[model samples]
Target: MTDSGPVLPWLVIRQDDNGNRYRVGRYATKDEAQKIADSLDDRGHKQLYWVERIGTPAL
Candidate 1:
């Protein structure tokens, strides 16, 4: 279904050591998204976490 509602532009992405990726969550602000990613990264796991703005290049 098409979503005419507001779209969350910020995304928290997680990439594991196995080369697999997952979407941790979405937010309206970049700071909020980055905070979530930072928290997850602080856990010290094999997975890598980062924040990305939707529609932008993935890194």
Candidate 2:
């Protein structure tokens, strides 16, 4: 088995009381992730956020 760190994609979604929601997904490729996020926003889902994790180099 291969060992994987916590350098994977993540999605953060926030919603409001007005029945609004937003989602943001992080991916190796920014475009792909943004697309998904935009789609969710279009569906009238509040806020969308995404973050990419970068691995640190061993000293």
Candidate 3:
């Protein structure tokens, strides 16, 4: 099966240990996403996640 989809790296920010996601943004590359995550980490936000698209299967 062939798959076609726009693959993007998503940055997720959490409020605390509760695992509640607060903010999310998508980037074209991992580097771009990492930059934002790094900045947020420097500011004291610990919970960060990288959600990557696995591409959607063609129908």
Candidate 4:
């Protein structure tokens, strides 16, 4: 089926010092990720990680 809905971008980022290389969560967009990062920073959640674009998975 063809979809006419507005597309939403997504990305994944790994948390720093989490001990799990694959510990990551999906974000609606990079902006969303940045917002989360800011919150984490405010909470003193010091960490480092990466972010990359991901395609919507087919169901």
Candidate 5:
């Protein structure tokens, strides 16, 4: 039998009123994070982007 490791989730970035960036959280999938971003925008949040980590992993 072969062992399959856990798939790390995507990282999400969101900015507040003061332009300070913050990480919302990690989601099981990219779609999940997008959904949360949409919800934040609907709630009047600003500058939300799904950050794509490079070189080193976000986690």
Candidate 6:
């Protein structure tokens, strides 16, 4: 789904090796968030990155 609109609703999340997760940033689309995540992952750090949509219910 295309999420480019008035506001940024995508979130970039990062989790380190210890399993601590935090917010990295927000973007207008999933692609933007993924791009940042990819770049960060490529840095060779022992961390994991992923993107999530705002308002998504936590499970």
lDDT of each model, Cα atoms only? Answer: 0.89, 0.50, 0.58, 0.57, 0.65, 0.88
* lDDT by residue (tens digit), candidate 6, 4-56: 55687899899988889899999988998999999999999989888999899
Best by TM-score: 1
lDDT of candidate model 6 versus the reference:
0.88
Question: What TM-score goes with each of the models?
Answer: 0.85, 0.41, 0.51, 0.43, 0.59, 0.80
Find the 10 residues in a row with the least total lDDT in model 3.
50-59
**What's the lDDT for candidate 1?**
0.89
lDDT winner between candidates 2 and 6: 6
- Writing each residue's lDDT as its tens digit, candidate 4 over 1-59 gives 12865444554454568555453566657887677656655666656555556654522
For model 3, the superposed segments whose C-alpha errors exceed 4 Å read 1-9, 13-15, 49-59
Model 1 RMSD, rounded to 1 decimal = 2.8
Backbone clash pairs for candidate 1 read none
RMSD of 3: 7.2
RMSD per prediction, one decimal?
A: 2.8, 7.5, 7.2, 6.3, 4.7, 4.3
Q: What pairs collide in candidate 3?
A: none
Error of 6 at 58 (Å): 5.2
Candidate 5, lDDT over the whole model: 0.65
- Looking at model 1, report the run of 10 residues with the lowest lDDT sum: 1-10
Clashes of each: 0, 4, 0, 0, 0, 0
Where in model 6 is the C-alpha error above 4 Å? 1-6
Instruction: Name the runs in model 1 displaced over 4 angstroms.
Output: 1-3
